[model samples]
Target: MPAVQETVDQVRRIDVDQYKYGFETKIESEKAPKGLSEDIVRFISSKKDEPAWMLEWRLEAYRRWLTMREPTWARVDYPKIDYQDYYYYSAPKRKPTLKSLDEVDPEILETYKKLGIPLREQEILAGVVREDGSTPSRVAVDAVFDSVSVATTFKEELKKAGVIFMPISEAIREHPDLVKKYLGSVVPVTDNFFATLNSAVFSDGSFVYVPPGVRCPMELSTYFRINERNTGQFERTLIIADKGSYVSYLEGCTAPMRDENQLHAAVVELIAHDDAEIKYSTVQNWYPGDAEGKGGIYNFVTKRGDCRGARSKISWTQVETGSAITWKYPSCILRGDNSRGEFYSIAISNGRQQVDSGTKMIHLGKNTTSRIISKGIAAGRSQNTYRGLVTAHRKASGARNFTNCDSLLVGDKCGAHTVPYLEAKNSSAVFEHEATTSKISEEMLFYCRQRGLSAEEATALVVNGFVRDVLQQLPMEFAVEAQKLISISLEGSVG
Candidate 1:
């Protein structure tokens, strides 16, 4: 019994240590005055060198935000956030624009190296070898430190394929027409509270454009890091896949361990034109606070995709493993005939974490289709909820929708809930819904132990299998990291 207990302790410690990216980068930053105000919003726009029209857009959003209230509809419970208490803008001190990987700051390069995200395309393609000498597949990455994009790898390679992949800040200056045409087209500035706030002060995120008939040669990705103390991160991502084009984009985020909670509000918009397809995947691993939930991040984000032309498709896959509180619903608007939308998610909460997430699919065109698969895992004293909606309008003749929500509870103190809403005005629309909740079975554990697996191993194995369906939807590089996160998140559930 003593030996078994010792093994359990060892496994828990190792699992906690797997969050190697949860460390701060010691870099100087220029921060705006702490708080939310008209001046602060203007300051952010001025700092970004945005055009006057853009500033007006932000001010409009700010005005709308003032009239709006923090939504309490989510099942998550957290202390009231002091909007004016944190720095709304923080960027690394002036540094030379990197012309090549060799010109990048060695410290920044080393930071990603530690996170297992290689900045060198050659090294990434050759494969990133772990300390154990195992190699993970190659991936291009845009590293965002605090509120700014520092470097984007494989830009030249992507350019040759007629893909435009760069920081949103750069896109605003180089391709204002494209930015103006679609910025907020999917999620308008009047959308919601958090999104309005983000629009007013968002610093930096990725911008991707896949030209017509050109499938992206490789996956494009962004790695966002938060380092400045008492600073809120507001990043905006915009992706436009032109007619007959295809692109898969991935996002990863992390923050240092802290005792005080930080705020992160972001907005992501995706546009798919006729016959185009876009796949977006995210692995969110921000610090989830200590065991007592003293410190962590409040993640509030608005993500939506618009299928504007016939036969377009957009899919969102996310694995939420961290954050003290998470409130997000990546949605889709199928406005074109025969368009399709999909949402696959795996939300795991442990150590007092709270997650309120799901998706919304609005079918407005003829014969549109949508699918939703959600898996929620709750351990320790955490709470996980799945909230979703599927709406088919009167014009959406022959529309079809299917939804499946599954929850897994690992301990008695944890909780899981599913809330789904469906609305169909069209008689021809077909909607199917299913849900199930289950606990780790003693029989399964006993069988695994008989097969020589430890209690902790058996529990982790079962949880992994439960989420295998959605995990398989993640990009290969992200899948590996997410698997580790799942195993680590379930550490203390077994006796």
Candidate 2:
């Protein structure tokens, strides 16, 4: 039998690319000038040639952001970020128009291959081959390398389905009507500090729209890798599900190893009209720095969905396991009658990582319902908290919400906290909030070991069982991988 340290060492040798879309596309980059003044913001807006109203929105956000202070309420501590230290836009300088998969740079393709991210529906669809001629996925993918969208797979097929999946920068040019009507509609520029900053200097991100009565035949996924050092990735993703439509979209992000923390403040908004459904999932695996937590990524994000029409539904499922400091809350505004909102999350923090994540459910219409299930795992001096809010307005008659928050502590030195606020004005509204905190039982580990499992294996099994409820909510493609991450994050922990 191999020694524990030796087995661990073998696993340690595995490259970072194992995480799907975890790739490095090293290319000479073009970037906006450092320091974000009004002129810099104007430069970004002008560079993208955004409409007048959008430009005005950016300026307004910049002004409001100046008045906002760096909030220090989080349990984590880090040096203040110098806005001048970052390049607003850093993209591959090449003007290659990769309308299809083949036009993408060979280097970018190779990077995705290392990350195990299938490029197109053909590649991942049903036996598409890579450069080496080996097959991986048949799923469609839009690979965003740095601040540019390099290649999109099966785009023509999606277009035939009346679906639009392109970069936000390209969308403003190609689908201006959709962009004009919906951009910043759900989450405005003045929403929050991070959102305001993202509004001012957003570089590039995906834009997706599924037409009415269309059940997108293919899954769409975006792979975002920020390779530029000292660059702030301000991406805005907008997803619109028209009446009687449905789409499942997934996003993943990763940054290069850096001693100085990089900033990733992205804004994602979803609009589901009458009888439409949108399912959004994210797996964020940014570098979490060293064991001593010298420096990594500060992931402050604002994500929300608006159930605009009766019977609309929006669901957010996230598996967060990385980042030195993670501050994100994906919320839903249930404004339509009988509209449904759901948030299922699994946040894992290890080795000095701190995560303050959860969801918000705002019921503003009659008969609205929401469900929230959160799982937090903390270890190794890390802190994980689930902060959620469920509110029912005065006219939101018959509003209902069910919340179950569970926290699992792997080590004594770590911390896990749950703060939930429930506000209901409608006498007909019904809300239930429940939470529990517990640690793994040594007897369970002993029982697993007695059944012929190793220590690591036993711990992995136990942790999986603990997160089983939340893991079950993930899509099949993501569940197995998320389970492995949860297990690996708690390795060697006994407390």
Candidate 3:
């Protein structure tokens, strides 16, 4: 029998839920009133102790949000979300002055430890050697528990390198000038409905600024966890790479399992100056409900990058494997002559999940270049869609772009779709787009089975090969984790 057929026959023999990051921690938390109003926005601003200008900004966004409506153009279906039924802010109760990790709640610390995040500097640097006997590269982490930053590692080291890596709230207080100048510069406050909402009630997120002519010493990361029930998580992150600077940033997210659906709306913006570069990566594994998809997270996010100066570059790589309903698009605006942009993504869906994600590349200057590569895998009763856009403005002479979209389906009940848009206003502009959708080949499955591999193993192997190109774009550590997540997400999906 074919390996795929065998896998289908055995799918009903085992019933297992493979989400290991669904455990919640017990901690006392402070929460705002359960509703959205002008007063609630003011309450959030007061909680952060932001300046008057910040408060006014929030109020303006809130007023604008009242006039906006939720978008429904995506290929995803979900029940209407009552904006007033969720807690806007929730944070662990702790002292205002925290000198070290010892002051953080022990239960929260254990939760992160269980999630494999290195919040301790010593543990990150403690005798961890690479295969070549050299110390492995370190990662600076900003841990955001529910609504506030619980801890940030390697502050001193990053400061010594002339890098500013801290929570955005701290940046608002310490480096107000930088924050004021760059905040909402890439993705405006009124960019979309979710972004406008985030601008009003965003709680906490990471902020990074790399000085000119300096390269960040190590990888910078932010880990977000949602633990509170009936609460929404909204974080806003901003990164700026000054002229001749370079930085690499990573983001990861997870949520506890619950019978009720939750909301996660986030905004991320990147700015690269002249001769600068920024590399952004994401590994999103939020809770995806159960086999029947009764409850899960509604992930709506907006992420964009701006190549603002000559010869600047920006790249985005993401591995998305969770979330019951996902609507996200990470884009880049090539506004500088000779600037470059790249997007590589791997999206996997299973067990009634719905994903509609891709990227946009806008060429606004002469000699600009952009590339997009997307791989989507659908299993069980899920639907995956890739929608992308590439456009060269009228003045963008000598612009070039290439896009490729591929999809793989594991079961007859699943679906994969691709929708791409391309436009070139200048005669000198060039563009190319290619897309394909297919299932695992029966001959390949039979060969793997003949080599003594089980049906499940063979399916995983084939899926891995299908996504290898996009996986190679991730960092070494993240690539390994993403590989394992793909296999786990496809388990019991063949039937």
Clashing pairs in 2: 123-137, 124-137, 124-138, 124-139, 125-137, 125-138
Model 3 weakest 10-residue run by lDDT: 1-10
Query: Weakest 10 consecutive residues, lDDT, candidate 2?
Result: 15-24
Model 2 lDDT tens row, 1-495: 113333334335453223323334577777888888999888888777777877787898899999987777656677778988888877777654655566666777777767667775563656646576655654567778766778777787888999998888889888889988998899987887888888888877889999999998777788888788888888889999999999988887777676778888999999999999999988888877666786678999999999999999999999898888999999999999999999999898888889999999999999999999998888778899999999999999999999999998875888999989899998999999889999767788789889887666676676677777777776676676566665556554543
lDDT of 3 by residue, 1-495 (tens): 123333433333444566878888999999998999999999999899899989998899999999999999999999999999999999999986478999999999999989978887876668676465645448899999999999999999999999999999889989999999999999888999999999999999999999999999989999999999988999999999999999999999999999889999999999999999999999999998898998889999999999999999999999999999999999999999999999999999999899999999999989999999999999899999999999999999999998989999887899999989888999999999889999888888889999987767788789888988888888887777777777777877765
Model 2 TM-score?
0.92
Q: What is the lDDT of residue 112 in candidate 2?
A: 75
CA lDDT of every candidate: 0.89, 0.81, 0.91
| Candidate numbers, best lDDT first, in rank order | 3, 1, 2
lDDT of 1 at 372: 98
Ranking by TM-score: 3, 1, 2
Residue 75 alpha-carbon offset, candidate 2, angstroms: 3.4
Q: Tell me, by lDDT, which candidate is best.
A: 3
